[model samples]
Target: MSTTRHELLTAFDLLLAPERFKDYGPNGLQVEGRTTIRKIVSGVTASRALIEAAIHADADAIFVHHGLFWRGQDGRVTGWMRQRLGLLLGDDVNLFAYHLPLDAHPELGNNAQLGLQLGLVAHAGSAGRFGEQEIGFLGAPEDGATFTSGKKLAAHVERVLKRPVTLIEGQRPIKNVAWCTGGAQGYFEAAIAAGADAFITGEISEPQAHYARETGVSFLACGHHATERYGAPAVAAHVAAQLGLAHEFIDIDNPA
Candidate 1:
């Protein structure tokens, strides 16, 4: 039994619901290749580097959080775009990307998976919720586990990122935390309102520095790509087990 690219892509779109949300980049398949997909690979971004990794791994399909053709990028497929897309097309590797849909998927979301990995309790959100406070999540570390200071938590993130995490307000402590994956500095207010003692995100902006100081919310800027790889890879593993497809998750180091 073999899985056609169409069948697998249909299942992914149905599962991730890429059409329902607005995203920065193209959400579904950016390149078409062979009809049959035997090996599936996932990564955080569809960079030329990642594409090379997929090709080296002999993957038939690559699913990612960041895809080509960003909303802000010029529509023309010139320069580096041509080279990158050409690599995928030439190699017969299909690319499937899901951005916001992957971030907000409740159980399979990056934020949720982070909480689970860190052993956070109070898993489910409050029974009744409203408005803007809905997107990010709230959770507490294990009760007996020593509460980590902001510096220590940043160190943990640094270890995960394999580089120093940007630690804002080095003096603060992180007891209750909330975070959203990707470039979501705009959601700082929502995290604060969720009673988060600390907030973690993929990237930070200039004004976010002022906002963090004024709001008295501890903020940590972990690498955006590092924080988002978990959910998509986890989902890929589940897909492999359920459908009996060969799958692997190759992590490409990203600085931003």
Candidate 2:
């Protein structure tokens, strides 16, 4: 089975609605490749390893959450950037990336997927939205379940992600929690304001430790790559099912 690049991009745009987001970079089809795409590869980031793997897999298109270009990066195509782009260009493989849209999507976004994996359920209705662009989510254990304490919650997260989680314990037991995956420590204050007992994100800054201690709100720093590895594959699976195209998820591991 095969689909045109235009069809694939249109499917993604409909699924993510990239225009609704004010993202740091463009959302769809970052690199143009062949007009016809039969097999697609998805990953968390478009690193050199992922590009090589996709090409080696004979993928016609590469779908990812992180792309080559960012808003403030120097516009020069050199160094690692040159090599990555060269590989994609040389093979004529389409590169599609979605940033904030991939984070904010209610059903398939990073936040939603991570929450699902951790067995957390979003608060009913509009209450889940928190932080800038309302990307952060406020939730709790599903089906009236509870974590009892910050340590318990941290353990659960670590178990689910299969990685060590940094925990700054709070004074109180954990009930309601807030989370935004992938370097979203900036949302901690907002999560606190929203009355979360604990806040979970990919990375924690220096100030969050003090804030967690002083404010008595738990903070957990799961790995950035681990938390964000779901959305791209989810989107790709949906697109593949819809378009009758073959899809594979290539995970290029990153410790950070």
Candidate 3:
């Protein structure tokens, strides 16, 4: 079964509501390909490897969290950019990407998925949003649960993500946690101000160590790619199921 590219994009727009976000890049379709899309390949990024893999899979469309164009990127499509674009253009495969929209969606977003993986729940009474455009989320363990210590929380996160986590231990137990996936260290201070016992994000900057020490709030830096790998595939799968199209999620590993 196949669906028109317009129908797929419309479904995504209705699901994500891209207009609600001021994202770093364009949200919906980036590169135009065949009007009829049968199979879609979803991944974390639109790197050369992912593009090649999609082409090999004979995908009619490529859906990703990270796409080729960004707000301040160079206009010239040369070097690596040229190669990636050439692959999609040559094969006439559609490229669809969603940035902040993918992160902020309450159900199928990166933050929500990461929280689910870690067994965190967004309570109704708490003010769940923080940071620019309220992209970050504040949540707690399910059913009034709390980690006995930061180390225990870190261990759980590491086990769930299947990767080593860089933890800045706090002076107190972790009860309420805040998180924003994918290079969201900048939101740490906001998380702290929002009264989070701990903050989790994809990357940590140099200053966050000191903040964690002084503020008594734990900090965890999971891998940027690791934290963001779920949203694109989840969104794609929903679209596929709705449109009766085939979908495959391809993970191109990146340790950073």
Q: Tens digit of lDDT per residue, candidate 3, span 87-164?
A: 999999999999999998888989888888888887564388888998899989876888998899999999999999
lDDT of 2 by residue, 1-256 (tens): 8999999999999999999889899899999999999999999999999999999999999999999889998999899999999999999999999999999999899999999998889997789889898899998888777778899989889889999999999988788999999999999999999999999999989999999999999999998999999989998998999999999999998998
Identify the leading candidate in terms of TM-score: 2
lDDT, model 3:
0.92
Residue 231 Cα positional deviation in candidate 3, in Å, after optimal superposition: 0.9
The C-alpha stretches of model 1 lying farther than 4 A from their native spots are 121-123, 126-133, 144-148, 170-173
Highest lDDT: give the candidate number.
2
Q: Which ten residues in a row have the lowest lDDT in candidate 3?
A: 122-131
For each candidate in turn, the TM-score is 0.88, 0.99, 0.98
Each candidate: RMSD to true structure?
Answer: 2.6, 0.7, 1.0
How do the residues 1-256 of candidate 1 rate in per-residue lDDT, one tens digit apiece? 4588888877787777877776677777888988888888988888898899899998998988778867777878788888889899999899988877787676776777766665654345572111243556666676635345777777766766576778676344666777776787888777777677777888888877776788766788886887787888877776666667888989887777
**Clashing pairs in model 3?**
none
